[model samples]
Target: MKAIHLKTLTTIAAAMVLSASFPSYAAEDMSKMDMKTPMPDASAVTEGMVKKIDKDAGKITIKHGPISNLQMPGMTMVFHAADPAMLDQVKEGDKVKFHVEKMNGALTITNIEATTK
Candidate 1:
């Protein structure tokens, strides 16, 4: 009976040692942290005005004043859209609130619908 008690204590001590060593080697997963915070998903967007539209080049030159993600050191300039078809409903001097996305190095307008009051 004394030998059995010694073995049980040894097993308990081994288990405690293993439990203490496990968390030290573990790392926290950062994938859950949202670094690319998304903006409000709404069609009610009413901002920016169109500066230029070129049908021949299939692109539009938007003088985007300031965008949330477009935060940079220099002033705003013209941006190119992959699909000029997005400009079908938009016209020069028309106020719009469009959202752009970068896909494979090209900045494209993913959403450019009209905005209501």
Candidate 2:
């Protein structure tokens, strides 16, 4: 039927337009997304031991002390690093002091340093 054909054409056109516009839409969506939890203060850095490090993924697993700013009690959890290059300074079993924040809806390490003392 002509009505069915017209509906199919409309759906296909809409899909094409959406696909073509998706990248911009996604970028805008990211900017508009709300973080449910407040970010931890940068000044309230925490000390932790690196349990794992995935350089390729820019993530690290740490067993940390209490993060008072975020109201997070110490536990081991994985976090994305703000700068992948900082991953180079750390390895598993190393002690580190790091800055954490709620970045793009997840807890992220914004600053990090490896330490022995």
Candidate 3:
């Protein structure tokens, strides 16, 4: 009985020491954390030309260079706008920089801006 109690106490002490060595995050306030996804920077934006804009369909067609983010080759394709208002910012034949992501089973343009070039 004495040996069993001694072994149990030793096991409990070892467990307590092991747990104390690791920092606990439970005490930290999660509400103060920035949980939103960070926006892609300018370097992540792909250069493209507006091939078409269909406001009624809430889509835009772009001829874009290789999109490294999507592992896509340079090609012309239609994309749904994450926000329909994004279509209002560009017209056909305009050079633009944009970012795309797969959302709701569709390729959606998350960001876009017309370029002087």
Candidate 4:
């Protein structure tokens, strides 16, 4: 009877140890953690004035015209560009029509050409 009791205890201990050693795959769904949302590739076009420029930081501030994101009913306000290179052909008080696109995690101007207006 003593041997039987020891065997039962040993079996229970082994079972517990084995269960604890491995991850609990049966309890929860692992697929949800790996899932990610697909974001759209959207670009913005604006006609604005260059308010500030920082060449080192790759950023430019623009007093944009009629920014829809701010619910702005056509007002002049400052915005930061994802790339400082956008200011290469532009400077303060220069009138330009810039095309900004979302890349990586920031809004950058992919195409910036000079305008006569």
Q: Which candidate is the best by lDDT?
A: 3
lDDT of 4 by residue, 2-96 (tens): 35688899999999999999967653577546543222232345677776777776776666666343244444544445445556778877776
TM-score of 1: 0.50
Which RMSD does model 3 reach against the true structure? 9.5
* Ranking according to TM-score, highest score first: 3, 2, 1, 4
lDDT of each: 0.62, 0.85, 0.87, 0.60
TM-score of 3: 0.65
TM-score of each: 0.50, 0.62, 0.65, 0.46
Residue 80 CA error for candidate 1 (Å)?
Answer: 2.6
Global CA lDDT of candidate 3, please?
0.87
For candidate 4, list the clashing residue pairs, or say none.
58-84
Lowest lDDT 10-residue stretch of candidate 2: 34-43
Q: Write the per-residue lDDT of candidate 1 for residues 19-103, one digit (tens) a residue.
A: 9987643235555555433434643222566778887776766666455554432234565665667778788877777776667
Number of backbone collisions per candidate? 0, 0, 0, 1
Top-TM-score candidate index = 3
Task: Write out the backbone clash pairs for model 1.
Answer: none
Error of 2 at 71 (Å): 0.8
lDDT of 3 by residue, 1-117 (tens): 345688899999999999999866654666667653445886677999999899999999999998888889999999999889888879999999899998989999988889963
RMSD to true structure for each model, in Å:
14.8, 9.3, 9.5, 15.0
Query: Any idea how many clashes model 3 has?
Result: 0
